[model samples]
Target: MKKIIIGTLSAMILFSGCSNFLKEDPTDFVAPVNYYKTEKEVFSALAGVYDILGNRAAYGRYLFFEMDMSDQCYMALSSTGQDIALYNYDIGDQKLVDTWSILYQGINRANMLLERIDQSDISETLRDNYKGEALFLRAYYYFLLTSNWGSVPLRLQSTKTPGEVDMKPAKLKDIYAQIIVDMTSAADLVGDVTAYKNAGRVSKSTVWGILARVNLKMAGAPLRDKSRYAEAKKWAEKVINLGYHTLNPDYTQVFKNHAQKVYDTKESIWEVEFSYMSGSQYEEGNVGSINGIGTSNKLVGYSYGAQKIMKPYYDSFGVGDLRRDWNINDYYYENEPATGRIVYAGNAAAIFYNRSASKWRREYEITPQKSVNTTTINFPLLRYADVLLMFAEADNMSPEGRSSQAEWCVNQVRQRGFGNLLPGAVPTANVDLPTGLDVVDFQEAIQKERSFELGFEGLRRHDLIRWGIFLQTMQGLKSYKASAAADYQYGFRTAENIKPRDTLFAVPRSEMVVNKLMEQNSGW
Candidate 1:
């Protein structure tokens, strides 16, 4: 839901060298050392933090869309259908590299602010707010990093040079410990969230929401330390008890017209704000305008003008799943502007048969020009429904896990997709299936519901990886293709590019060369 596919701005944005806060101050720049003087300065520093998360490397584009191609969201790109190679991997595979950079950038910014906050003379209330936010952002960034890389340097200080970060990957145990520390501390410092101006910015519920997710990730497959599930449940419950956010009464609001939900609705816990003026939502620009289109990963759902819905995934929906319609759309209108005319692209008969995404939902207001670049849709990163789902994921995985609570939680989410309304009121998931769902069945159901409820929201790849399902799913998806190029037909991959380990990622050669401390993941 946090991903906006405007068009192809291009591919992942990466930089070899990092930025410096105080290296050179613009004449209008607030000095890094002196910047935290007021609440606004603190807010200004956080502007790009979410942008970092949404980078094309993350959900901004490829990861969410492509991962969907694997499972719930959509079918893989035609190349992805054949290959699952570098193209599908632009985000998922290379994410480990770009994430290393983007997250460290946020962490450094947060650390610098935390290091200098006390001297700012901001009021204690504001001071705590800034510090709490910095801690939360740092923890969130680490969550993004550790989820993928596992063992990464926990750099607490802002290093201006490479020599300063001669740190090696910390144990995953230690990394989670750090996440807990920052999150718990952040929870204590952050009081009521009053910032309604931008729904994407961090607030108290946002902190707890993140804590719930962090703990859920820890409790699940890769780490498999079930003890943390109770902790995850605890954080989720905190967010729930606050009663700040609620499930969207309408499923489509979370995606199509997501901006309308941002500032006005009770559904969003957090969102990354994008605008035609003022702030920049970088991910939207990159994916919307960037590289995916002409390739198999094209924003066009299918060759047919049907708003891009993939075949198998679309078929996966059950009898009365409201989500199917909520998610799939057919593109019909053509825009004739002074810039030119946009003949609707995706619906090209049998050639490309896919439904367009409900979430790629962009600006109805922006007249499409040949160089179309206006989007009003905001990305929802967290929602009330996710909190409930995380609560279920945590409780079900806990040692004292109550089956009823977990069932209730899962049902709350599924009920909506099954066309039941009023949040958790659906009796379908609540009632036991004839054979009755056991732990394994429930766990599998949770994973699928997570995908359905949160498709295109940017969590797919991480969820797949954590479940240890990515490799299996990627390989399974690869087999469905007709081949890389079939007499210039669909489903063909160059044999050299496809492999199981490649499903993970190659350590960016740059980091391997520069930092001996970094070891690559199993496959490149």
Candidate 2:
């Protein structure tokens, strides 16, 4: 159901060192004047926009590894050089440059598709849906841009010529306002979740879930627009009240479905699709292979094992929390003694520095002759669990305080994490939130629970920043690591290098070079 195809459409926009400044000649792209005459062509253009989600600079690798790492996870100590993950990189770092470029490419693609879709002879319903998706995608690209760079050039129109590069940055609040408007409009136009057979396409449920996320960000730091908390609650309520999604009872199975390439449309509301080998090209990703349990042995499924779990995060889980061991690996694959077959080996030697992420295990991939660099495991964008937690946070922050309904939402996620929600399941102790927590206590609980439930899924850094404790949290980790045994010193690198300016990535140097109107973020 998650089919992504980049056809002979030569309208692909190439970047000049991660900047959007390019002079397009007649041969550079298919003239939009003649294209967009058919439904299939419009859909192909939309697919091109979605294609950026899995780009190496975006979700496919760096988003999780470079941007998302924090108190929850850190780059593997085996990594040789200091980079963005350690917060030591500058504006010219190619990772930031590539991430900036690819995100703009997506925006430009969405802009082009939206501009021409009305020219196509598609059905009214289909055209509306396409427009909704384009708007949402453009908002999403801006969301990532604003989330990282603070303020950026707000290019709504397609880049038709080289002169378009001189646009100035929009205010952060203005950018967020535009995001809400576009996503709200998108929510009205997209189809219901049930209308789609897969979680790959944008649906009403997906838009609602992400809108809640967007509002929640606004409600938090830098903006501190507490009014947006109500908006976040409203959007999350729509998704829940729709009765279209539920917590998949098995926490591990949720990710196992991802690794096995099985679509769980109810739980995973939206995902960035990737394929092992499509046509002559390998449209695969590093989801499991880069972040999964590390081993160089091809038989055990090759992974650089580059993502390491911090011990404090591992120990934060209470007893009997099933997600603890599943999210962080306690054992790793190695060549078996007798058969030489790849098998799990207890990680007795694992210190704070060596534990790898375990959510997307490559051993579960069904493809033959597994490639060392990539796997078909899809990266989830919006999951139902996230919506529930967002509802809880917004509800607690609202004037009404934490309602019984809000408490129930948080407990529902915990119940699943503790394996208490399975059919014919035995009641589990310590699976529910303690009775009678004040609003402050409840907010703290939600924060910790988010880390426990959603760790290493590329949300923790944003969560920390929104709570306005990103610096203190990293410093806390640094202190913890510094005081630990000498052997654990290797895990101290990221914490040691983090700085306040790191809250947002420096605007890419490539962009600064061409766009004279571009203003660098403070302290860059």
Candidate 3:
């Protein structure tokens, strides 16, 4: 699924050098004066817009480990200095600044491409697809911004110079409205999943699935736009009715495909592709190394095993549910003799809280001589299972109430979780969610189901925040950890440090300095 365009596009950015810093454009070095002249150049520019998804500040690191350290997991080994996981970060925190800057860079790249792509003489079909992708990506970037920062500067046009950086913030609802508009238009313009045959590119299914997610966010806390629930269900049903995607039968194989740099489009609808080794060098991500099971031996993939699954999340899995062991490792790798052999703990209560998130184990990586700090595993952005769950959740939230269709959707996911994939295979009674749950009970079921299926995939934080349970969930962890053994008390630091303002991260000081019209979020 990893494309060759990444190398060419990055090289284009690097080689677009300037002799005089004062005279050259500062917003982006890949100047339009000499670029976007041909069809291939336009494609390369589109790849540049996609490249930011793998930047170190996004899915490459902070997204899965740093920003997403919610009630499900915590960093086992703290970094040398300040860390965002504990929620002690301020406006000047470099992690926040890098993430904010990287997202804007992506938006700017898409803006530049969209602004110039119409001049190209490419085939009408291809040009429209590229335009659609750029529009969707620009909106997706804003989704990340408003979802995290509340209100933000909605820059539709590319910035030309340093003087163009002082735009004021747009209200959160306005930004969401633009997201819906851009995504809705992109859905009509983009090709279908069969056309792309991979999750790396934007397709009709990708746009609709994500639109469901965006509307669900609006329907939940903060926005409280209940009408959007029906809209979310409408988009999610579109993806389902398209009949191009389904569960991959084996749940673990879904992630194993990512770990081994393979694409399974049936399960993974969209992904941020991270690659390794073009010719002599590598471009990788800190997926397995930082978040996988710990091992000092490079041969087994040197991992700090930074993240530990919270014991409560570990225990949330029901008996005979297969996802528990696959997601939360029940063992560690010994560093002795550099072979990094496993040391099984058998899901013992003593070590429950110490288990690593093993969804992206480096042992599955086929590349030779894995890097000490990075791997080629891709990060999934949207999956079919997620779409099914979203549809169910939205249907339950709609005035129609919980329907049999919603129950069936949740059952399909739960049955797969219990390893019942074949049509004739009987779903384990204990594993399947009970039928005819009331509105509130069914909603709670969807919440736990999402955590069980999508934990440690860089989504738990946003899920908690949108559901209005972020602070309560963190505080719940504090009480849960308080009852644990003394050694486990260290896990409660996140809850202790969290404040109501922690719901929205502070605007980066760098942006505040330049955009004088921007006001800080509540409580700095």
Tens digits of per-residue lDDT for model 1, 193-256: 5554445557778888888888777766578877777888988888778766666666765554
Task: Provide the lowest-lDDT 10-residue window in model 3.
Answer: 15-24
Encode model 2's per-residue lDDT on 1-524: one tens digit a residue.
01112332474533111111112221335667888778766766777677788788887788887788899777864456578888887688888888898888788888888888998999999999989999999999999999988989888887766556777899999999999999999998988989876677889999999999999999998899999999999999999999879989999998988877788888999987766543311466788888988877677678888888787887799998999888987666655332233334643334545777879988787664678788777888889999999999999988976788899999999999999988898978877899899888999999999998898888999999999999999988875664445665667788888788888888888889888899988877
Question: Cα miss at 133, model 1 (Å)?
Answer: 0.9
lDDT by residue (1-524, candidate 3, tens digit) is 01112113344343111111111112244446567767767776777677777777887888788888899887777644356888877678898988898888788878888888888888889899999999999999899888888899888887666577677899889999999999999998898888864578889999999999999999987999999999999999999998878898889899889877677887898887766554312357787888888788777787887888788988899887889988988667666455555666454545876678889888788675577877777789999999999999999987866778888889889889988885577767766677667898999999999998998888889999999999999887876864556776677778788889988888988888877788899997
Question: Sorted on lDDT, highest at the top, how do the candidates line up?
Answer: 2, 3, 1
lDDT of each: 0.56, 0.81, 0.80
**2 against 3, candidate with superior lDDT:** 2
**Given candidate 3, what's the lDDT at residue 212?**
97
Q: What is the lDDT of residue 7 in candidate 2?
A: 37
